[model samples]
Target: MCRLLGVVTHAPTRLADTLTDLIEPFTGLSREHCDGWGVAAWQPDGELAVSKDVLPAHASPAFAATLAGSVTDAALLHLRMASPGLPTEPRNTHPFSAGALAFAHNGYFAPVEAIDELIDPDLLAGADGDTDSERYFLRVLTRLHDEDPVDALALAAADIRERAQFASLNCLLLTQDALYAYSEENPDSEVSRRRGPDFFRLRYQARAGRVVVASSGIGAQDGDGWSLLPYRQVLEIRRSDLRVSTHLVRGALVGAGG
Candidate 1:
């Protein structure tokens, strides 16, 4: 399991001011999910900037410096607690990037080999590490060139569902103009049962021209305005206007849109 935090706003904002309160406390969660941390921010000229460390967020001076130095209208942050067998290496870190897109996931699934077979060869060839999350992101990126982000995600979910079962597929996908997120879980899966119900909880708050969607820990503390995003649902927040939209991912697949 892991923690995810994302923000999209109408005005350029410093991460220190926009997310420090929420993220500072969230880092303490690394005490349990202490594998690694990664952050991705969209630059003013529409490029993606990423920083990652294999060290746990709470203890990493690099993590603290990156957060305080970053200023952007759109950003994605992840704290990873690696599943069994995966290493705590920079390549395995979250907020994986390809082109202008960045992705972070907060769950586990099986049959990684099967998932790899479904990814585009070109993308798979460039893979830096062997985490299922990175393979999943590559699969999504392949479809993104031909389909809208939402549709691409839905397709990726559908494909994964066909290949294997997943405990949860909660993820955040960041593009230059928007933030896309989703929450999905198979309640009967062994991983899900072990992690407990709240393990996959996701929520969002849209207020004061800023919108944020995150895993339970961060959103839960945002107070009165937060709303739980239903399981199997995808959320989109446009950075241009801070508009929000929601969609149900068809079938048992877990997908995202923006």
Candidate 2:
């Protein structure tokens, strides 16, 4: 399990400035989810930057330095809690990057070989980590060859749902153009039961200047302009204007409000 936090601002702004009140609460989650931490940020110019470490966010000076006033139009933060048999190393950290896209996942799937069958051989050959999350990201990237970002994620997620048993497929995908969030999970999974029902639930808030999406642990309260993203759905937040859209995995635009 892990904690995910993504932010998109109408104009480039430091994360500290964009998420003034929520930063502490979000990073504070590292006390428990202390395996490692990673961040991916992008500027309006379409340049993406990523930083991560094997240290817990609360204890890592690198995390503080990266988040302290760095300007960006969009950013995604991940606090990882490694699964039972996974290693806690830099390669296994969240926010894995390939080219211009960065991905962070908050779930785990069983019998890695089962899911490995879905990835492209060449793509799988380039993997530097032994995590199911990175493979999930690569699966989405493989689908990106023909489909759009949202669709690629949807297809990859749908495939995982059908072929492998997983606790949660909830993830944050950050691109040069937009920020994508997908929420899907098996409530009956052991991890879910151990954590609580809301463990896999994702929530987002669209403020006047920015849109913030995060896991349930963030300090967001109900009716505070925060809305829980529906399961089996993906939400897109345009970087240019912060326009938001919600879509079903099967290709229906449920809502475009935000």
Candidate 3:
């Protein structure tokens, strides 16, 4: 199992306040998930900046301070727990990036041989490791390269549902102009799967004219208006404005001409 953290804002702000100070501490509850942490951000100049380590988040002073000073308009964070037999190399960390997109996941896709045909070869072509999540993200980018982010993501979900038997495919995406997220239906019937939340929620607030989106509710008293995204919902947040619409993602391959 793993954990994810993301922030999409109208302005470039440091990650310290939200991630290191707020989200990283939460990983302690999931014992196996403390393996390592990494974060990827979209550079205003069209490059990606990612910092990853094979060490636990709580013990890494460099990572902790890096989070405190990191600045970006959109970003994704991942806390990993390597599968017992798998090596804990830096390549296996989450928040894998390609071009203007950054991807991270929270579950495993075992017996990967079964879905070997569905995954794109190019995805593995650039992978630093053999983790299934990286393969899945690469496959998704293949379909998304020239399409709308919202549509590509929905289509990718349908493709993923076929072999994963309920992949906890909670992904955070950072595009050139917006931030998107998808929390797929968790297939808990599988023994090696991790649990996911019933709700996939996020919020975007106007701060000094910049928009900020987050997966967690803001404010200690819960006074904020956090938008609740349904299981198959897609959200686009940019410049403080949010556009949300529901799309049936799970059965994308089955109900095609309907």
Candidate 4:
């Protein structure tokens, strides 16, 4: 399991400024989910800038520095609580990057091979770490060849749900163009039962000029500005205008945010 935080704003903004008082509480989640941490931010030139470490976010000097220094219209933050067998290392860290896209996952699937068999051999060959999450990212990337980010994720996620035993499929995808969030969890999975129903839930808050989507434990309460993202759905926030659109897996846009 992991914690994900993504921000998309109409204008470039520092992460601290965007997260405000919730920043520390969010990073404090590292106390329990302390395997590693990573941040992917967009540069003014539109290039994706990524920095990560094997250290816990609460303990890593670099983590604090990156949060304080990153100034972009979009970013993704992850605090990892590695699966039982995965290692704590840079290669296995969250926010894996490929070209201009960055991805972070908060769930795991069994036998990793289930998803591996579905990915292009050439693309699977490029995997740097032995993590279901990384493979999940590659799976989505593989689908990107034929679908837009939203559709690609829906396809990738559906394939996993059908072929693998998973606890959750929630994730955050950051691109120069928009921020994408997908939420889905096996209601009867061990992790879900252990972490409670809200464990894999995702929520977002969209106000003038900015939109933020995050995993459940960010001190967000119901009836607050945050709205729950429904299951098996993808939420897209275009960076150009912070326009929000929601889509069901393999379905049409069902609603809009803010």
How many clashes (backbone atoms < 3 Å, residues ≥3 apart in a chain or on different chains) does model 1 have?
0
| Per-model root-mean-square deviation over C-alphas | 2.7, 3.9, 4.1, 3.8
Candidate 1, residues 1-258: lDDT per residue as tens digits?
899989987887778788756876788888888999999998776678999998999999998888788878999999999989998889999989988899999987777765776677888999999788888898888877787888777677667767777888889999877899977778998877887887788889888868988887654743588888887678899988999998875643543322
Model 2's alpha-carbon lDDT is 0.87
Backbone clash pairs for candidate 1 read none
Who is ahead in lDDT, 1 or 4?
4
For model 4, the run of ten residues with the poorest summed lDDT: 249-258
Model 4 misplaced regions, further than 4 Å: 251-258
* Per-prediction TM-score to the true structure, in the order listed: 0.93, 0.94, 0.78, 0.95
Better of 2 and 3 by lDDT: 2
Total clashes in model 4, counting residue pairs 3 or more apart in sequence or in different chains: 0
- The sequence of per-residue lDDT tens digits that candidate 4 reaches over residues 83-105 is 99888989999899999999999
Candidate 3's residue-wise lDDT over 110-218, tens digit each?
6544345655676655667777777667767876765577766666666666655544556767777677776555545443233333322343343443333444422
Off by over 4 Å in 3: 18-24, 27-32, 44-46, 190-224, 239-258
